[model samples]
Target: MSVKISLFISVIIIIVFSAGTFFLVSQQTSRLEDELLYRAKIQSVLGAETVATIIEEAIDNGVFSVNEAFDTDYQIFGNFDPPKYHTSYDSYLDRAILSIQDKFLKDDNLIYAVAADRNGYVPTHNTRYQQSITGDPEKDRVRNRTKGIFNDPVGIKAAENKEEGFQQIYHRDTGEVAWDVASPITVKGKHWGGFRVGVELSSISAAQTQLVKAMGLIMILILVVSLLFTFLYVTKAMAPLRKMTVVARNIAKGNELESEIPVTRKDEIGELQDALNRLRLSILIALKRKKGK
Candidate 1:
């Protein structure tokens, strides 16, 4: 019975500890993900503001006319089949935007930093994508200049709303999970376009997985240690009761009492041992009286 009770208690302890450990790990993971998303949003908005400032400065310096530049209509080819831009006119703003995007891409998590006109025309993209295509379908799809139209839901939302927003989206070019953030680009009080920054989620997910595994291993180790100590302590503590059981059984079977049970400490187990000794003494007295008669 004592063994059963000990085992039950150990099981409960294991359950409780496991639940608490899981909750703690879950909370930590949630916090980490939130922090990562927050940082991505900040970076995206900052990039947008920086690009907007550059365009505004160019306008002030008489480098470009906001009305002509923003309203320029570029032709789209392929009839929405991975639509490509067919334009002979290039703006000096393209070089500046590409340069800023290149700096933003230095961060490993940042997948792309791009800008598009209000009409969803991309004049320039990251240098890697701007490089001449090499006939690889995957490479050409992302690298070709014609592939840069900001017509996706997130981009269109940014352009239409003219405000900053964020969404979890898959990259159209690479199909990777990412946090897509967009901030409006206004030049000289005109809604020129939006700046978008895509931050990949794979790194954050990998870190979370590694953390959970580590925490799980630690929890398992703690459980093993706890169970070991509980088992040993329960066994040792029940030794007195086991011995008393044996003595009581012998006395009832008319067998000789070989030794006295000792009550070493003032605990419940000691009290039990004392009670069993009194019963043993009474039995011996009764047997002696019967024999004399």
Candidate 2:
């Protein structure tokens, strides 16, 4: 057909492909977010339970006290030395706990840890917790939340079930959320308090965002390649049409119309070229008749 019509079809194909790509990308983003959030929540719970079991074992053997190991003056895990008077068991247990904390830090999702008495007193924590909760307020909040066995869900659950763990979502800061995991510290069937761990949503959210951006870049690259190919295809298809235009222009300028359009495909453009050839023959016949007259 005409060049204008061919270009219109190409534009329509491009639009349809673009819309399909956008919809697929949007669905992929949603699925990724949902799966990441669910996995983050489950991972937080597993981490808290695992660490609590280690602490409970140590406590059972009388190796360490919740208060002594995590006191302000005592730093167990990173670069800090264990107390000189600590028993061999204490040192082993402290090292184990520090190793767990180090692993949590390495994971991008982890946020905080809370070890409190039946009362919600902040005990041991990770770096994110230290940054989020302020000095005395952090302690007071924990204490207050644990005062009435009813105040803290994790506290009460741990106290009641004497189980290893519980998980929940906590709004730690305005417009920010964390997945909290807590496990009971029971020594010889007696629950002393519990251990809590918090995994921030931001880490997972940021990862998802980065993934979407990378996918977007890939889509843009594909579109660019498709556009390049389409331009090439259109240019090739229009070559015969351009030849026809030159022949018509020559005929208009009183030059001989000897060249035939070379388009062989039986499409609308081919049909139009054939009609032009017929019209040229009719014009030549009229010129011969007038010359004889």
Candidate 3:
């Protein structure tokens, strides 16, 4: 019975400890993901703002002024014609995208990069855009559509006059993903275009998997240690009871009551030992009286 009780207590303790460890590990992983996402959003917004400022400065300095260049007099910044201007503009855009992508790459978890203008034109991609561009309905829609951020599939309410922000978007191929941030580079309060920074959802999941693996290892270690300690504790606790069991069996077999039981505790076990010794003395005294008669 005592062995059963000890086993029960040990099991409960193991379970409780394991549960707490799992919870703590899970919380830590979630917190890390949130922190990384927050940092990504801030970094994306900063990159967009920097790009926007550069463009605005270019406008001021006649690098590529708004009206004379695009010829699309729509009061909105549109395609810059002439190979030179596009080349220069694309060069600047590429540098910014590359910088952000390098930063993401430096972090081991992040895998891909995508930045689109408000027009959703693919500005920068680590992968060959044509390779992934399957001739599918979704791709067709993306190619045809002109505006709206599509990465964070869920609509994160675009900030009022947002120069930069962040959201999550989903790809039909991959569902429920996270984006670090997406920001619009605005000039003169008109929506020129935007840049988006994306961090793969796989990054978060990968981290979570690593954490779970680590926790499992720790739990195994704990269980092994606990098992050893429980065995030692139970053996020590039941030692006196084992001895008492042997003493009772010998008396039932009508053996001489000369053997002594050791009393090492003041608890119930000790009291039982004292009672057995007194009973042994009484039986010996009765035997002597019987011999005299």
* Candidate 3 residue pairs that clash: 151-169, 152-168, 152-169, 153-169, 153-170
RMSD of each: 3.2, 7.8, 5.7
Question: Model 3, residue 119: what's the lDDT?
Answer: 38
Candidate number with greatest lDDT: 1
Q: Which digits, one per residue and each the tens of the lDDT, describe model 3 over residues 239-274?
A: 888888878777666575776656667999999998
Per-model TM values vs. the true structure: 0.84, 0.63, 0.73
lDDT of 2 by residue, 114-228 (tens): 4444544334434333232233553533422211122356445543444454666767523458766666655445565666656667876787688768777877787777766
Ranking by TM-score: 1, 3, 2
What is the Cα root-mean-square deviation between model 2 and the actual structure?
A: 7.8
Best model per TM-score: 1
TM-score of 1: 0.84
Higher-scoring candidate on TM-score, 2 or 3: 3
lDDT of 1 by residue, 59-144 (tens): 67877666655755666655433566654434575666677788888877777777777766777778877677566767766666
Model 3: ten consecutive residues of lowest lDDT: 79-88
Q: Give lDDT for model 3.
A: 0.58
